[model samples]
Structures are given as C-alpha cells and as structure tokens.
Target chain A: MKTDMSIRMRTMLYGLMCVLLIPFVFPTWWMVTSSVKPISDIFAFPPDLLPRTYDWSTYQRVFELQPFAQQYWNSGYIALLVTAGTMIVSSLAGYAFARIRFPGADAIFMVVLLGLLIPAEVTIVPLFQMFNQWGMINTHWPLILVPVFGAPSVFSTFIMRQFFIALPIELEEAARVDGLGRFTIFRKIALPLAKPALSAVAIFTFLHSWNLFLEPIVFISTPQMFTLPQALTQFTDAYGGAMWNIQLAAATLTALPVLIVFIVAQKQFVEGLAHTGLKG
Target chain B: MANVTLSQIKKQYGNTPVIHGVDIEAADGEFVVLVGPSGCGKSTLLRMIAGLETISSGTLKIGDRIVNDLDPKDRDIAMVFQNYALYPHMTVETNMGFSLEHRGGTKTEIAERVKWAAEILDLSNLLKRYPRQLSGGQRQRVAMGRAIVRDPQVFLFDEPLSNLDAKLRVAMRAEIKNLHRKLKTTTIYVTHDQVEAMTMADKIVVMNAGEVSQVGAPLDLYDRPANRFVAGFIGSPSMNFIDGVVENGRFTAPGIDLETPSFTAGETSRQLICGIRPEHLVIGGEGISAEVSLVEPMGSETQVTFSLPEGTIVGVFRDRIAAKPGDILTLGVQTDGCHFFDPLTDLRVE
Candidate 1:
C-alpha cells in the first residue's frame, strides 16, 4: 500500500514538475531560436522550436552596434573581482564571528547582519553621490566595491557564518595545539573545509555583479563603460526603435558563460559539501 | 616527561563558575586520570592544563615554567580529543606530521617523525588515507599517532575511546596503558568511566560537582574511598549504602545491625551510612536475609538484585544462584572491607 501511494505521488510530482518547467525553459529556448531567425519571422505563430531561417549576420551586428567584447570583459572582470573579494572578506568575518571569543563579538555580528536587511536599491542615491564626490562615477569601481563590501556581501557572510558555526570546533582547537596561529589556522584548516560554502558565495557574488542592470544604467552613461546587461539594451535604432535580433544576440552571449560555469563547477563543490557533514 | 601542577585553578563563564578552585599535582612521568560524571568539570580542568582554557584564578606550572598564559603549542602539549579531531582533508601522514611542519621542521624530519609514529601505531601502511577512509578504531589510533609525533612534554586525552565499541574500548585501554609505560610521559586523561580509570591510571582524581572528591591510587580508591560519593562512584556495580544510626557500640537500621569499632566510641556523630560493594556479598551465608528480586548469570559469577528491610541493592556472587526470584538468600557482608560515612557530611568516618 505504501509503495502504491509513493508511486502515484511520484508520478503526480513529475507531471507537475514538467508543467512548471515550461515557463523557465521556453523563454531561453525562444531567445536562442529567435536570435537567429529573421526579425520578421520571430513572432510567427506556433513559435518555431528551431529557427526557420538563419540570418547569421545578426551575430556580427551585435559587435557592430556596440563594443560587445569590451562590455563582456567589463562584466567578466568585475564579477571575478567581486567573487574573489567577497570570498575573502566574508570568510574572515564569518570565521571570527563563529570561532573567536572577544568582547561584544555577538553584538558586533548582529550589527553586521543588519546590513543584509537593507537592499542596494534603497541606498543607491547616497552611494551615487559618494562615488560622484570621489570622481569614481562612470567607472567599474562602484560596481566592484559596493557589492563586495556592501549588503550583498552580508548575505555571503551569513552563509559563511552558518557553515562555520556548524563546523567541528575541535579541528581549530587541534590546530591551535598543532602550533598554528589564528590566521594560519583559518587559511590552512577552516578555508579548506569551507570550499562548499565559499563556492556558493562565489556563485552568488559573481551573478550579482554580472546581472547588475540598474547600477550600470544609473552610474555609467557611455556605451563603452556599460556592462553586458546594460549594453544589451543599447541596440536601438534611431527614433527609439528596438533592434530585436542584435539585442537577443547580445543577451545570449551574456547568459551562456554563466550557465557553462555553473555546469562545470557545480559538480565539484556539491560533492565537496557532502563530505563536510562529518560529526568530527 | 615533565610534571604538571594546577594550583587553585578556577573557571568561570560570565559569572557562572563551572570549575571552582582546585589543585592537583601530577608528578613527572605519572599517568593521572580525572574521572567523574558528565558535567563534573573533569574535562574543564584538563583543558586548562592544555592551555585551551583560561586559568581564571590560579597558577599552572609545567616543569619549571608558569605556563598559565601560554598558548597550547607553546605549552608543548599534545591532545587527543574525544572525536579524534583529525583533519578530514589531509592524509594520515600529513595529519600526524602537521605540527612538526608548523614548528619549522624540515620535510625529511617531519616525514621521519610521522613514519616513526605511524609504525608505532600500526598505521604505517595506511598513511596515505584520509580520515574518511579510516574506521573508528583506526581513526582513534591516528589521533594518538598525531599526538605521539610531536613528542611533547605532556599528553592529554579527553575520553578518546568513548566512541569505540565495547570490545575495542577494552583493547585500546590496554594499548594506552602500554603506551604510557613505554613513553613515561606526564599524562592527564579525562573520562567518566570508572573502569577505565581503575585499569589505566597511576593516580586517579575523582571529581564531583566542580570539586575534587578524592585522589589516590586506583586500588586504594577502590579499597577505601574518602566519601560516600567516592565509594558509590568508584566501584563497578557501585557500593550500596544503608542509612542508619549508631548507638552503644552497634550500628542499627531497619532490619540491619553491625558491630561498630571503638574508634567512633562516645563520638557525638551517631548518624551513619554504611557502604558495601557488590562483590563483597556472599550468598547462603549467615547475615542479612534478602529475597532475590532478580538473577543475572554470567559464566564466572552471578549478579542478584534483592531487597532487604531497608531498600533494594545489587550483589555479585561467585557461586551460581541456586534459587529463582522470591527465594530467600541470607547474604554476608565482609565488615572488614566495609566503609562508614557520616550522613550529614557524607565524608567517610574511621
């Protein structure tokens, strides 16, 4: 009776899952198919599963319309910097909060977590003014610095704190006995054990900087300085008309690298996480 | 090997005093075991000695130096934690050699020391395996091996065998004893198991409620505990207590009477508690009559639970119990080995 019930439940779950998958899968499918289709045939009824005809020159138009390669580099390097910076900052703060015993440590950690409650959109006006005052406006500095040290990093810090709090404290004790000072133990012992949590933080921080459309549009005015997300919207003809083929072509390029990175590194870090649940 | 002295050591966590001021002296090359119930502050005192905990109000000296503020590594002690605390990422050889590397040992020196420890622990063949690849007993040996590679001035073990199966615990107990004999290190081990303490300790410190109850050799504590708590805690089946009053050269309770020695003669303290061990009671003898409540038989001996007029207590008889439950067995208590405590103070009386 239990097996019968589970079988029916599983079939129903799969049916619901397939139904839920269409909205997520179809848009990417449409975007890729429509990027190659002639702009006239894009909205053809009973949407094409495969492109009916390929106008391969649309890809060339993506680079011709804007410095697409430059924008791609801007997003890539900024995301990489943010990921690396957040990993270092958050892990150190998280380890100290979780393991160290100092005066008012808990109170200080609570104050840091308050950053997570505020979003970047709410503080953009002041941030823009500060960056403008420093002559960092229209540069990638605001994009790189804000997310690494600001509210987004707080979420990463919280993830790292939760992971470190569950970590076997005895390992640190053993390291201390093994002649390691605090920083050495953090680097050699705590950091290696924290690969899974750090990977998750990396994925979040990278994507945050990669898909930062509002910040780019607000801070950067020149097409040369625009990130990929902002530059995708720049493929417009005169009289404010949208260039559909070139825009889709640019958008696809922006999304594919992130998708491929997730596919490759996810297996490594996911399995590493399974090994951290040991009681010791 | 060096002596470790903890003088009036105290521990408090934000005004909550967990370990009250206590003093213990472990002579050089002595194996000291701190045995107590859980939460009795045995482990706390060991951590203080290891420099892992702050000595709130005392001087802790190792050999010739006052190391109260020294770090664990600087104190030159190696500890085996209860869960082994092996670095999960490193191989067994690296885990054992990790300390030597940090202390600026050359690669060859570290490797040679690790190899020596591995050979001693029978882990020479498994040096390349990670902790996840080892079984519980093997991991325990690796933890010991890590401590051995350092060859520190002192060794500390915090209930390191509690995670193993019973048969393995017995075997490891012998191994640790043999290791202590060979190394002759000033060691402090903490456990709640009295049997482990009795078998392995050169000197035993029994603690209760953040205070030291007694300190003596293992056989000395078993033969003559200093208090009711010590008497009750040190024995295997635990010593049974009969509460009563002594008057006119005899101690008497409900259906209980025993001749008193003249040492407490005319003493004002009449209220008494008598203790006798399970193995001291002999069945089918002329003494207190008890109806057998249950009978548990081992091939070497039989354990019988019974009720006298006062209360229920357990007894182990070398001979087989002939009768079933509800059978009357007159049991004898070896009074020469019996103990008396003053009920008010719970301290043993002469």
Candidate 2:
C-alpha cells in the first residue's frame, strides 16, 4: 500500500473488489426494490433491480394485516433495554476481570467464556420450559433477559475485557494516589475512557436483539407481542400462502430504522471498533 | 516535608518473597534514590512506601504515622510513574487538579493550585492541551506538575526520565533535581541508572537480589565501597577485578603484585579479590607492567585495555598515551582508591 502500483494492476485490483462486493450489495438492492414491486412482477424471470411498476398498496397491507405499530414498539424497546443492560453487565464484569486481583478470577472468566461456545439454539428448549414454569412465556422477559444475560453478552464482555486490559494501569493508580476510591475510579476514570468500547457493545447488542427471530417465535404467541423479525413473517394470505410483496414491505419497514441508525453513526461505529486504541 | 522510615520491610507474593527484610531512613526533605539492576526489588520498595504495594511484614512510618494499613490516597504521597500516567481524556489543568478535587478543594482553590504548579513547571502555555497532544518532555513535566499540585509529604518517582531521549533525559534530570531543591519536599526516586543515583541522590541505596548491598552518600560509596559488588557497580565501565591470593606481605595475581590491603580481621596467605577502578590506574609509574590491547580515545580521556597474562584490565586516563594495540605500558593501582575483598565471600576486606 505504501508504494504506487502500476496502472494495469490497480485497475485489476479495483475490478476484483467490485466483483466481490456484488453478493453483499445485490440482496439489499433486491429487498428494497421488491418491497415496492407489484406481487405478480415479484416473480419475473429477469428480476427488476428497480421495480417496473410500483404498488403503494403492499405497504398499506403491512399495517392492516398485523399489529405492526405495536410490534415496532416491542422490538425497539426490547433492543434498547437489552443494549443498556448488556452494557452495564459486561463493563462491570470485564473491568473486574481485567483490573481487579480477585482470587480465582481467571478460573471464573474461563467458565464464563464457555457460554460463547454454546449456541442459544442449543438451550432454547430448556429456557422455554423454565420461562413457562414462571408463567412468563407470553411476555418480553425472555427476549430481553436472554440476549442481555445469555451467550450474546459474553462476546461483549470479552471485547470489553480486552479493551480494559489494554487501558494503562498507571491511570488508575494515579487516580488512587489522587484520592479516588475503587468505585470512584471506575466511574470517573474507567467509564469515561471506555466510550469507544461501550459504543461498540451498544451497537452489537442493539442489532442482535433487533434481529432476534427464534426467541420471539418460541416465546410469544400473540401478534401484538411480536418483535419486528417475528412480525415480518406474519404477512400471509388467508390460506397461509405467502404474500410476497407485503412480506417484503414489512421486512423493509423492520430493517429501515436500524439501517438509518447505522448510516448516521457509521463513522463512530466503525472507527470506535477499528481503533479501540486506549493510547493512555 | 516529612521523614520516611522503613524498619525491616518485606514483601511476598504467596510464599515467594521478593523483598527481604530491609531498613531505610530517609531524612526530612532529603532525596533518597533506590538504585539497582532489574528485578532487584527497588521499585517494589518504592511502591510499598507509596502504598501501591502492601508490605507483607515489618513496619513503615511517614512522619509520625504508621501507614502500613492505609491506602495509597490516605498515605499522602504523590507518585510520578515512568509512563507519566496523565489522564488522556482530561486537559492539563484538570489532570493536575484531580487530586485537589477529591481532597475537598473548592473550584477557585484548585484552579489557583493548578496555575501555580503549571507556572513552576513552565507548563502555563500547555494548560488546555491533552496528554497525547504534548511532546514527551512536556508530558513528563505535566506529570510532575500533577504531582507538584498535591504538595504531599513525600514525592515518589519511579524512573520518571527513562522514556526520554538521551539529551532530553539529561535536561529533565537537572530539572527534577532543581525542582526538588525548590520544593524541599522528601523525595524517594527509583532508577536502574547508576549515574542518576550518583548525581541526584543525597543518599543512595544499592540493592541486589532483594537485599540492600550498600547504603550511603554517593561519593562515600564510590570512595570506600563496602564490597566487590559495590565497587564494581558504582562506577562507569565498572571496576577491574583480579582473582588472586595474598601470601606473606604481598598480594599477587597473574600480572598483578602489590602489598595486601589490611583490615581489622587480617589473615595472611588467604584468597583475595582485588578491585581497581578504571580511573585509578596510573600509567608510566613504578608499578606492575602489562601490554596494551586497545586504546579508546574519549575526547577528554582515553580508555586503555591491557592484555595481562591471565586476564584483562581497562583504565581511563586523563593523560593521553601515544599507545597502539601492541604497545607495552606499566600500570599500577593508586592504593588510596584500591579495593580489596574476600574472594570466597565477595565482601570487602576493610
């Protein structure tokens, strides 16, 4: 990258990259265009990259067919709660494991990391039975609690711990010598300096909970309690035939808010993750 | 300012003890340096005094208070780490006044103190800059400025200048010494460089393998080192040691023959270790003879390494000899600065 390449080689390299970008770019292109297409034209042999004819009625059916407004609120609030909850739990656990000299900390951290190896699908049955025993099956507790305290949070904790470890020990020691106690040091020094890591944790936790599909279908039986991903599948006709255009419309609505958020904060989201540079 | 005292201090991790029982009495407003090789427990001792590391045993007292159980904040000492642990998020003023904020100082008082410290450290122009924005020397001064604002009983510096370039290190070294003179606060510095210890310390403690090898004024240790290790460690280019034995009235080695240095408990016909400083060797004198192997001209002085029959010895002389690698020279120790030790024990004879 330091040296300038020849004109032919640079052209070939950019050509190769463009070819590799198609599969990732085409699906989103189709998803947006198909959402606006008429149902009959959705199955056209040469798919309309841009819809040949528009139908605003499919978007109207998206709200009428289900409690789409309520489902939107459900997914939004659950993702927010899960993001905030995961941030707290992960930062506390990660700072303790990385900075404190507690006995058997390494052993406890290893046990916690085992959660990463076990997929949530592997334990969903047991979790459903437990939630049912507590009469919480139709509630959002499983949706919120599972992602916040379950395997998804372990990755956040691992990332936070890695960030906190690279934090210079002298800063905390200087804080201590400056008359700050352990909790005060964590609050004023550690937390303020952990913005990049916490932001990264927030984005990942939000997207994970927002796109959560399996837990919602298993836990919630009511259409009103459906999350965005669960509600996206409910756009079907009377005989259970897929309403392809309406389904795509609901999917677009479900994915739009998060996409907008990503676009708005993409710089911080990517650079915060890329650097994680605790250059203390 | 307060005098710091450590009586038989020790530190251990599990069952492995890194600092054996040691005692140091740093006078009020005095600068004491703990200098040693790496892993010699000098930094551990400094941390123990700073209350960053707990003492596994023994007593430590600052002023009149027994402070072994106190936290670092309560110990009333300020430490400047080698890395200059300035808060990356805060400006220079905020970082320096952070301690005063915790100690219940008002906003005006904190600002005044920060301003005063910044002025003293010549950092007034840098009050708003973050740590990463400052150069290495400026950051180091800000670190010292942070310590200065506290105005604590004692100042602890853990190799504060090790990260600077050579020229900056010398400049900062003088600045630190000048700061200590102005403040007149008790200071405890830890470093591995002997020159820093030699030039700056009012009293220097030389440690090895978790034990205090020797402790005295710098020149006192230099003039009359307690053992072969102290003699070899205190000087640059180190001292030349010859393994030999003393028989009757004379001590003799392969190319060294001199009168045996006498001590209180003297024994004739015994194994001995003779230590001669590089600067103490006199050329063209009525003394022992050896062949020169190399002549290193160092501007004001020249270093000559002589190839003895059994070993080699190096000498730094102010008088430049017209000598090459194959030249012959007569070399003799000026017994006034000569050191003799017990070969078996590696302890000083006197």
What are the lDDT figures for the candidates, one per model? 0.88, 0.90
lDDT of 1 by residue, A1-280 (tens): 9999999999999999999999999999888878888988888898879987888888899999899999899999999999999999999988888888799998988998898888778989999999999999999999988988998788778778878988898999999999999999999999999988888778778878899887888889998888999998888999778888778888888899888877888764564444334221
- Candidate 2 RMSD to the correct structure: 2.6
DockQ for every prediction shown? 0.85, 0.87
**Residues B1-350, model 1: lDDT tens digits:** 79999888899988899888888999999999999999999998999898888888989999999999899999999999999999999999999999999999999999999988888889999999999999999999999999989899999999999999999999999989888888888899999999999999999999998889999999999988999999999988999898877777677777666666644656554778878799987775554678889999989999899888879879988888787899987777775656889888999887
Q: How well is each residue in A166-241 modelled by candidate 2, as lDDT tens digits?
A: 8999899999999999989999999889888888888889999999999999999999899999888887789989
Q: Candidate 2's residue-wise lDDT over B37-130, tens digit each?
A: 9999999999999898999999999999999999999989999999999999999999999999999999999999999999999999999999
By summed lDDT, the worst window of 10 consecutive residues in model 2 chain B runs over B259-268
Question: Looking at every candidate separately, what fraction of the true A–B Cα contacts under 8 Å does it contain?
Answer: 0.84, 0.95
Query: Interface RMSD (C-alpha) of each candidate?
Result: 0.4, 0.5
